[model samples]
Target chain A: MSSEYDTTETLDVKGQSCPMPIVKTKQAIDGLEAGNVLEVVATDSGSISDIQGWADGTDGVELLEQVEGDDLYTHYVKKTE
Target chain B: MSTDNPTTSVDDADSEVDAAELQALRERVEELEASMAAVDDGDDQQKMTIVATQGSFDMAYPPLILASTAAAFGWEVIVFHTFWGLDILHEEKSQDLKLSAVGNPNMPMPNALAALPGMDAMATKMMQKKIDENGTATIEELIDVSLESGVDLQACQMTIELMEYDEDDFYDGVTTGVGAATAIQHMAESDVQLLV
Candidate 1:
């Protein structure tokens, strides 16, 4: 079930290439409040690793859960202190 | 269109032609010289480089697409694959790549719809065919183009070991070794650093 802490944000980078998804996600996270959560949806599978790396690279965000299924990889990340 | 030395040379021995013909020849010579100078101004070429490390199926397209296009500009390009990015290097290319429906909120179908019987299998097959036709080149093609364009290929030893991969695990030009600091220093000197 979706909870208050679980908010969804979709990023359509279909026609676009790689790094773009990561870059767009970075911009999306930047616009949110600290501690706020974001659920990113991307057509590019690269976004999965890209987002994970982005969070690790930033060192301030937290990757709460990564639900990987056959075709989708729904990731949950929270903005942290 | 002034000629520095407008002299009829020995090569112009046919100067005995009528004055009208001589005048026309001079005008043609002047026009040719002017066009030559204009051509010289447009001959210089600009250069650029792109480094793509992401190797997932969907991730793979970014590097291949960017590399092929950037190379089209006649710019020097180098694609480095390390860690999971090495998925593009998987021998069983089919298993190495996936269109990735996981976490893909933008996917048109809901989880139930996606899982509606054997739809998932069909979707995966469809995506593969689309990418393949759309120039989602195979790992072999990726490595070949990089070689033809003089792309320097570097692999991360740490990542390789962590993933329990070996030399046979990589392709021809790949050299096994290089860490993050190295990538940073290298990219810092590049015109573009594209992390897929």
Candidate 2:
């Protein structure tokens, strides 16, 4: 369902909760080169706002979009630095 | 000769006005540069300081959760575990921290029933079960995340001495025996401060 941006990596945090979604997202983005996009799949409902708020406050990363499926949340993050 | 004097004065006044405008523009550019640099350095990084004063099973989550979350946000986070809060950083104590139902109003049972001999154990077990069922991060897991994310975990010196806790009792990477003065200094310098 994600076709807008070419995702460089996909991080599966489907069952992780709270800080793990964001923490794992950060780690994934860190390993990526600048301009690379990361796709995050999560089951935690809080990841919607958590990833948004995290991207809003953090530098060198941009949250492109969030796709909500039947039971999963997909977040597209771009490493801007 | 009179014409020459007027022309000379006008030219002189025009040059003086230009010099004043140039100086003002220069000062404005310097001010803008300084603020831009501040934004690059100071505004980019924020600091948070928290004083954790409780050690119950329920109470332990807030500090660690907030600390790890803040660290994820790229903020410098410091959590000072004082008094009963020191139990959270204690390797053995943290794993076995109990939920006391005796004085807790949140418990559904009557205070009398909650004060029964085995109530604390039952409550602790119930909460642990809930945490497991929900897939929530355990206290130990949160501690690991906080450390891995570079959150500064500090233990109160006075509490360690009063409780006769060995310095080795705390988890690795925790800054043990930190004085109140150090905690206060961090709080003063932090952009956000909390006591929980």
Candidate 3:
């Protein structure tokens, strides 16, 4: 499913906990240009909801796809504006 | 019969208009109260203040962690350090802050083992190691993050005078050195206050 969208950059925050994943994701997303996709891979189970909720609250970033693989959670966010 | 009398009928009409006006005024007061309540609620939801009074390794983490996390949530966060807590802001003193296993019910080791001569140091090292292994940010790193995220770090002026410490003893990013009165004022205005 990752092959569907073009990813501009990938951030692997595998061992990080709750807010770190969200914080790093926010930082990574901020560094991207408009319309660029950021692929985030995190091991924290909380990231599934955390990233979704963060994207929901954030204005410019859109959560495109979220996939769960065994112990890893992958989120694709595109900078919309 | 009253309706048939012109004077009584005029009086009834006048009373009806007065009642309608009274009802409109009541609704207006209710709307004003609701709007004022909303303004107060907004004021209460945006600011938080935390006071740190301990300098141990375990004690240092809470304020830094909370301040950084709260700032990330777009809150106006202030962390005031007084007494021993001021040690956490000092580069040399911060490294010497140790976790004591003695009398700590939550310590993993039994009392007898924890009472050993070197147990406190051992516990401190073990805890630091575990924190690093968990990829949790160090106190210094969290302090930097909190400052970068706009969490105001303050020192107690009275404590500095009492302890005979100068401003040079503390690291950068301490923007203010204030008295307890100032800290109390901030706490009174803040929506949330925590002492750790």
True contacts kept of each: 0.00, 0.67, 0.30
By lDDT, who's the top model here? 2
Off by over 4 Å in 2: B1-39
lDDT (Cα, tens digit) per residue for candidate 2, span B37-152? 98889767899999999999999999999999899888999999999999999999999999998889889899999989999999999999988877789999999999999999
TM-score of each: 0.48, 0.86, 0.73
Model 3, which residues run further than 4 Å from truth? A1-8, A32-37, A52-65, A77-81, B1-45
Better of 1 and 2 by lDDT: 2
Ranking by lDDT: 2, 3, 1
TM-score of predicted chain B, candidate 2: 0.82
For candidate 2, list the clashing residue pairs, or say none: none
| Order of candidate numbers by TM-score, starting with the best | 2, 3, 1
Q: After TM-score superposition, what is the CA distance of residue B54 in candidate 1 from its true location, in Å? A: 3.8
- Give one digit per residue, the lDDT tens place, for model 3 in A1-81: 466889999999998775677767877887899999999999889889988887876668899999998899999999998
Q: Which is superior by TM-score, 1 or 3?
A: 3
Which tens-of-lDDT digit does each residue in B21-125 have in candidate 3?
A: 999999999999999999986864578899999999999988987787676556789899999998888777887789999889999888899999999999999
Query: How many angstroms is residue B150 displaced in model 1 relative to the true structure, after the best TM-score fit?
Result: 1.2
